[model samples]
Target: MTAAVAQSLSSLLQRTTIEDHEAVLKSCNAVLAKSKSDTRAQHVKAVALLKLDRYEDCLRVFEDAGDALKQSAGLEYAYALYKCGKPEDAITIVSQLGAGRGAQHLEAQAAYRAERFHRTAEIYEDLREEHVSMSNEENDLRINSWAADAQLQWKGQSDSVHHTKATRDDLEAFETAFNAACLSLAKGEFGQAEILLTRAKELCRTSEDLTAEDKEAELVPILVQQLYVLNKQGKQAEAQALLEEISISNISDLSTKKITQNNVILTQQTSPNPYVLYKALNASPTPVDNDKLFEFQNNILVGNTHTADLLVRKYDGIIRSTSKALSQSPCPSVSPSVNLLAVYNAAAHAQGQTGALALKAICPLLERRPKDLGLALTAVQLYASTGNTTAAIHTLEAFLRGLEESISEDDKDARFNPGLLSVLVSLYKREGRTAHIRSELAKAAAHWRDRSEPCISLLQAAGTSLLHSSDRADLEMAGTLFRSLHQRQADDLFATAGYVASQAVINYASIENQVDQLPSVSDLVADVDVDALEQTGILPSPGSVAAAAAVIAGARGKRPAAPGDEKSAKRVRKSRLPKEYDPAKTPDPERWLPLRDRSTYRPKGRKGKQRAADRMQGGVVSEKVEEVATTVKSSGGGGGGGQKKKKKGKR
Candidate 1:
C-alpha cells in the first residue's frame, strides 16, 4: 500500500474504540478494498474482526494474510487464538516476539490464563522499566492486577539468593529490601516493611566502596521506597527531604515509579494511609509530625484549626507556608492544585475568612476536574459547612448533571454513580429543599432501577429522610417513595419498614386530628339512635339483651321506680334500712327447704307417686322393711299360722 492509504487507515483506526467494532471493521474493509494484497490492510481487517468477536473469522483472516506478517500481527493473532480457546498456541506466539511491550502484555495474559503466574510476573517485571509508564491510570490498574496476581502466586517463596544479594551493595540491598517490602506491603505489614526499607536506605548511605554510577543507579529505588513509606507513615518532611535529594533529570522517572506502586495499593481499594489527615485533625487538636503538618499546610488535606494551631505554634505561620507551596507549583498540575485549594481553603477558614473566599480560591481546580467526584464532594461540603448551602447544592447539581451528560447513550443506564446523587440529596434535605429532592431522586431511581447499588441506597436514604421530616406532605411523599421502592425490591428491609412507618405516621396524624375535632360523649350519644344503629349494623348487637340492659341500668347509678318498690324506694331515699329487716333472715318460707326435697315436682313413674307420698307423710319407706315382713309371715306358715289358725288370727 502507498503512504496515503496507510495513513488514511491508521487515522481511521486511531478514531476507533472497543465500543465501535462495526466502525473499525468498516474502516478496515474500506482499506482492504483499495489494497487487496496489502498485508497491513489484511492485518487491520483481522484485528477489527477480533475486536468484533468474530474469533474464527479473525483467525482465518490471519491465516490468509500468511506467515510473513505474523511478526507484525503476532499480538492480534495470539489474542485471536486465546479467544478461540487455544491459549497454549497463543502463549507460544507471544513468547516469540522479543521484548516488546505488547508482546510482554500478551504473554503475561496468556501465561495468566494458563496458570503460569510465575512466568506472568517475570514478563511484567521485564516490561516495568522500558516501554511501560505509569501515567496512564487504566494501564496502571491493569499492571497492578497482574502484579497482585503474580505476588499472590509467589507468596511464601522467598528465595535464598535474594537474601544473599541483600548483603552485597546499595542497589542490591535496595532491590532485596524493595522485593521484601513489596511482599510485606502486599500482606499489609506496613510497619515491618517500613523498618526493612529504612534499613535499605541506611545500607545505601553507608556503602564503603560504591562508585558514583552505582550510587546514582541505586538512589532512585531507595528514594522511591523511602518516599512511599514516609507518605504512608504520614512523614511528609522526610519525604520532602528525599524529594529534594532527587535530581531534576530523574523526577519524571521517579514519579512514574511512584504512580506504578501507588496503583498497586489502589487496586486493593484500601486507603493504607494511617489516617485521612484532615479527618484526624478535625477529630482532635492533637499535634502531628512536621511532615504531616507540612502536607496539611501545603493543601494536600483540608486541615483543621488544630493543624493551623500546631503550624502556628511550631513554624509560626501556616497560611504563609501554604501560599509558599502554591507559589512553588505555578504551572500547577491537577494533583497539586487539589492540595493547594484544600490547604488554602482550610487556612482561610482557620483565619475566619468567609467560605466564599476559600471557595473562590479553588474554583479553578473545580473547573479543571469537573467530573472528579471526590473534589466535587469536598467543595460541596466546604460550601455547606460555611452556610452557603444553596451554593453547595448548585455545585453538586452541576457535577451530577455533567456526569450524566458525559455518559454515552448506550451506557447511560449502567454507568451513572449514585454517590453524587446521594450527596446532592443530602444537601437538599439539609437546606429543607425537599421539593427538589424527590424529583431528583425519582430520576435517579428510574435510571438506576436495575444496575447501580449506590443509587438504590441513595433512594433508600432519601426515602427514610423524607419519612422523618416534620412536614406531613413530605412524610406522605416518603410513603409513596418507599412503596415504589418496596414494589421494585420487595426484600429491602429498610424500604419495607419505611413504607410501613410512613403509613403509620399518616394514619396516626389523621386520627389525632379527628380526635381533636370530636364532640363530648353526651353530644355524640344524643345524636345516635341505638336501635337504628344495631339494625343498620353500625353497632354490634348484644349477645344477651337482658344482661346488657341490666349492666347498663346498674352503671347508670339510679334505680328505676316500680309500683311494688315504692316502699323500698322511700326507704332508699331516706338512706336507711326498714326496721324489720334482718341481715341473716330468710326472705321467704321456702328459703330454708331441704336440698333433696326443695321442689314439689317429681320424676314420673311408680317411684314418682311413692316419693310424693313419702314426702307428704314426712318419712321414707324402704323395700327392706317390706321384704322382712313377708319373710316372717312365710316362716309362720304362710296363711295366718295355718288356715285353722287363720280364724283365730282373724279374731
Candidate 2:
C-alpha cells in the first residue's frame, strides 16, 4: 500500500479500535474514496458502520467487497452477516477462517445466536487461552460467563433427551431451571422467570436433595436474581418477604469465597448488604457503614427522583437509628461527644426534619468545636432546612467573622476560605442580599471554580435563586452564572434549561410593548368554516373538520384581541347593524353553529349481519337481505352518487 493510503488506514484503525465510531466511519469513507478496492479500508468501514448500527449498509458493503476482501476480512464479514440476521451463513464463514481471536469470538457469538449451544461452548473452550492472555478483564469475565451459560444450556438440553426418568436429579434440575430462569429474566420474560425460580425454590427447600456446595454456588445466586427481578417488577413487598427468608450472611460468604472448581478459580467481589440497602431502603440485615451510606447517597445524586427519595429515606433512617441509640444509652457507642450529636442532628435535618431537636443538639457542639468548620456549616444547614434562616445567617456570619479575625492576624487557613465563601454565598442569596451574594460568589469563582463540587452546587443554587427574582438585573446576573455553569458542565440539563429560560425572559423583557404583535387566530385562519373546509377538500373528513373547528374555537376563546390591535378597536366601537344581523354579509346559521357534542350521542357501533339472503329473480325476491352493507364511502367523492353514463356518439 502507498504511504498516504497507509496513513489513512492507520487513522481509520485508531478511530475504529477505540470509541468514536462516527469519526472512524467518516475517515474510512474518505480512505475508500481514494482506493475503492482497498480491502482494509472496506473492512474497517464495515466495522465502523456496524458500530453505528447501520447493519444493512454494512452487510451490503461486505457482500460487494468481492473474494479478496472476504479472504482478508473474514471475521468482519462474518460479523456483518451475523448482525444482519444471517447467523448460519456467518457461522459457515467463521468455521473456514483461521483461529484468529476475532474470528473465534464471532464464531462463538454466531453459534450462540443460532442456539447451537454445544458448538458455542466448544469454540469458547478453544478460545479460552487467548481470552485469558487479553488485558481486558471485563471482556474476559463476559466471555467466561457466556461460555458457562452455553455449557449449562447444552447440558440441560442433553438431560431432557432421556425419556426413562420421570424427574431429573435435584441438583441438575435446579441448575437447568436456574439457567433458564436467568435467560428468561435477562430477556425480560418475568412471568417465565418467576415460574422457573419458584420451581428452583421448591427444589432448594428439600435440603437433603443438594450438597452444601450446590446450595452455596447455585441456589443462593438464583435467589438473589429472583430478588432482583421482583424488585425490578415493583413487587417490593414480595421481594422484602423473600429477602427475609434468605440468609444474607450465606450469600455474603458465597460471594467472598474464592473456590477452585476444576482448573478455573472462580472469584466474585460483591457484598449483598449494600445492594439490599439500595433495593430496599428499610432492609439491611448487616450494619450499614457510614462511608458506604455516604457513598451510596452520592452515587444516587444523579439517579432518578425516586432513587434520590430512597437515598434521603435511607439517610433519615440512619440518623433516626443513631439518635434513638444515643438517647437510650448514658454514653454513646463510640463517644458521647458533642461533635457526634451535631453530625447526627445535621443528618436528620438534611432529611427534611424540623431540626428543633437537632438545633438544640448542635448548640453544645458549636460551643465545644468553635473552630470546626464542618460543625458550624452543619448547624447553619440544619437551621436553614428547619426554617431558621436568621440563626443560620448568624451562625455563618460568626464563622466568617472569626475567619476574618484570623486573617488579620495572618493565621487564616486557606482550606476554610472556600467553605466559608460558599456558605456566605448561599446565605446572602437566601436573604436577597445581592451585593453580598455577588461579592462572595466572585470570591468563590476565583478560589474554588471547578475545583470543588460544593462550589458548583453553591453557584447553581445562587443562580436559581436569582433566576426566580422579578428584577431584570438579577435575571441578567442569573443568566451569567448559569451560562458559566453550562459552559463548565455541558451535560447539566438543569443548568442548560435555566440558561435558556433566562434568555427567553430577557428577550421577552426587551420588547417595547407588553403584548406580542401576533396576527389574530381568526385572521390567520380567516373565516374558515368546518363544513366549507370539508366540502372544498381542505379537510379530508368530518372528523378532521370537527377537530379544526374545536381548535379554532379554543384559540378564539383563549386569545382575546390585544388592546393596541385593530380587532380591539372594532370591538369597542358599536356598529349600526342589529345584534342578530350583519348588513354587509348575511350570516349562515348552519355554518356558524357549533358542532354537535359527539360524546352524548349513542354510536351505531355494531350492525347485525345477514346469514341468509335471497337472490333477485327479475326484480322479485322471496326473502329480503337481513343486513345492509354499512361501510361508508368517502364524502369527498360525491357521496354515493353513481357516475353518469356517457351517451354513445352517433356515428
Candidate 3:
C-alpha cells in the first residue's frame, strides 16, 4: 500500500504490455501473496492473468480489487467477464463505462449471447444509421446491419435488412457476400444463395485484405453453406463431392453429417439395402421406406417440382404410382402408404390443379381405394384448395357416413383430433348451416371439445368462424362455446378473444338490466396476456377490444330504431357476391363446399400475386427440414468483429 510497493506493482504490469506475460504473472502473484491488502497488486495480477488468456483465474484477482478496479481496468475486466460466460455481468460493466464504441460493441455482443436478438439488433442499427442512405458499400457498419437483420429473421421476425445496392465487384467482398448468401438460403432462394456462396469462396481465396491466418476462419463456413445449398437443389452428387472437400475443426451450424447420411442412403443400395426399392405397406410405427420419402420431401421443400415429379415416378414406378397403389390397397384393413399421398400431392400441386381437374391425374385411385381415408382426405383437400367446396363437403360427408366417430381411441389409425372434420365444420359455418353443427356434428364436436391441443386450436378456429356469422343466433352460439373454452384455460388467447367479442356484441344488443354479464369480461381484460397474438400476423391487435367496448357503451345511450323509422328499400338491393354458377353446366367449383371457402375466392389477378408473396415471405419450408434446418450461427456486434479468416485446411 506504500508508494514504493504500488510503483513496483505498476512496473510488473508494464512487462505484460511486452511479450513477458508469464513472468509478470508469476512475479505479480508472489508480490500479492506478501501484500494481501494491496489493491494495486491485485490489479497488476489481473492484468497478467488476462494477458495470458486465463479468464477464470483473472476473475478471482478482479473480485479482490472489486470497485477499485472499475475505473482503470474496466475494459479488460468486462472482456474477461464476457469470455468467461458472464455476459449479463459484462453488460452491466459496459453500461457503467458510459460513452465509447468499445463499450457499446461489448454490450451488443453480451446481449446477443443472452439471446436478446431484438436488443442486439437495436445496438447495431444505432451504429449503422450514417451508412443507410448509400449504396455499393463494403464497410463494417453496413455489413453488421445486414448481419443483425439476418439474426432477427432467424428469430422468426420479418427481416429489415438495409440492402445497399451491390456493384459487380462487391460480390468479391467475402463478408458481405457470405451474409447475403445466408439471407438467400433462409428465403428458400437456393440458386441465388449458391451464386453468392461461390463469390464468397473466390473472395476467401483471394482477398488482399486478409492475411494467411485469417483465411482459415472464413473458408470452412462458406464451403459448409455451399454443400447445403447444393443438397437442397437436388444435386446430391455435387453436395457429396463438396462435403468431402470441407474439413471443419469445430463447426456445428450446417447439418453436414446428416446431409452426407441422406446421400449415402440414396446411392442405389438395392443389393446392399432394399428399403429404397419398394413401396412401404405399413402406415405407422415408422415409414417402412423412409429413405425415399425423406429424399422426396427434401425435393418438395426446395420447390424442385420437376425433380419431385420424377421422384414420385421413381418411388412407386410409373404403373404403381398413387392411383395404382390405392387400387391395390386393402380397404379398412389399412390405408395406402403416406408416401403415395406426398407423391400425388406434389404431382397435383406442380400442375396448379386441385379437386376434380386434378382427378385426371389420379381418378382411378379414388375409384379403387374408396375406403382409404388418406386418399379421400387428399381428394377433399384438392377440392377445398381449388374452390370446389361443394365437391369437398359431398365427398367428406359421404366418407363420414360409414365411420361411427371422427376419432376412435380403439383404432390406432383413427384420428384423435379433427383436421378433416374441422375443414367440414369450417365449410358448414360459412354456409350458415347451424343445423349441420347442431344436428349432425354435435356428438363429434362434444367428443373433441376437450381432447388435445390440436382439438382446442380447431375449436377456437370454429368459434372465430362463427363470430363472423351474419346470424345473431350464430354469434350467441359462438360466444357460448368461447366462454366454456376460456373458463377451461383462461390463458387461451383465441378463447379469451372470442369470449370478449361475443360479450361485446351481446351486451351491445341488450337493455341496461342485462349488463350484469359484463364484469367477467372486465376482469379478463385486466388479467389476460396475449401479446404473442400480435406476432401471428393473422390477428389484428386487441386494441379493437377497447374500441368494441366503447362502441357498445355508447350504443346503450341511444334509442332503438322503431318500425316507422326503419325505412324500406326504394329499389331491390343487388347481391354483392359473384353470381352463382351451375356446376352441372359450367363445371363451377364452389357449390359443393360450405360457403366460407367460396367467399374467400378472389379472381386471379392482384390476389394471386399477394398470395404468392405471402407463401414466400418467411421462406417456404417443408415440414421435415423445418424441424432440422438451423439458421446461420449469428455473432454479435457490428461488422467490426474481426473477420474470421478460415484457411482451406489440408484437403
TM-scores for every candidate against the unseen true structure: 0.30, 0.29, 0.41
Superposed Cα deviation of residue 523, candidate 2 (Å)? 27
Ranking of all predicted structures according to TM-score, beginning with the best and ending with the worst: 3, 1, 2
* Candidate 3 local Cα displacement, residue 187, angstroms: 1.6
Model 1: residues >4 Å from true position, as ranges? 1-67, 71-219, 231-382, 398-416, 429-445, 449-651
lDDT, candidate 3, 1-651, per-residue tens: 565675686566555455588877777776766666566667777877887878888887677676777567898788888878777888888888888666777888777666566677788777565344334332655566556656655544553444533456447478878888877776678898899899989988898878866786578768767876886788877876775655543433233333333333343233533333222211112222112222322433323322333444443343345455445554433322444444454455336454566666654665665456766677777777778677778877776665544344533234323545666777777667876755444344455665553245556656776776667776776777786787777666667667767667667553243244345566868765565543332244354764454444445664333346635324434564357633257655577886435755554788675555445648666655444443222433456456676788897
Weakest ten-residue segment in model 1 by summed lDDT: 288-297
The per-model lDDT (C-alpha) reads 0.59, 0.58, 0.60
The alpha-carbon deviation from the true structure for residue 323 of candidate 1, after best TM-score superposition, in angstroms, is 24
- Selected candidate, larger TM-score, 2 vs 3: 3
Candidate 3 residue 105 C-alpha distance from true site, Å: 0.3
Question: Residue 510's C-alpha lDDT in candidate 3?
Answer: 39
**Which prediction has the highest lDDT against the true structure?**
3
- What is candidate 2's lDDT per residue for 1-651, written digit by digit as tens? 676876667565655555688887887787777778777778878878878878789878977888887888778778878877678999999989967777777887777666566666666666664545466533453434343453443334332121111134322455555655665664567877788778877766565866876766556666666776776687766876765545544544322121111001101213444443354432233222111111222222213222323344666655565457445643212221433443554555445444777667567766765655556777887789888788898997776666656544222433335445666767776888887665555444444444534356667766776766678877787777777787777677667766765667678564323123333567768776866665454434454655566555455574444447765454434565557665478655466444332323333333311111122234433233322322332334464566576789987
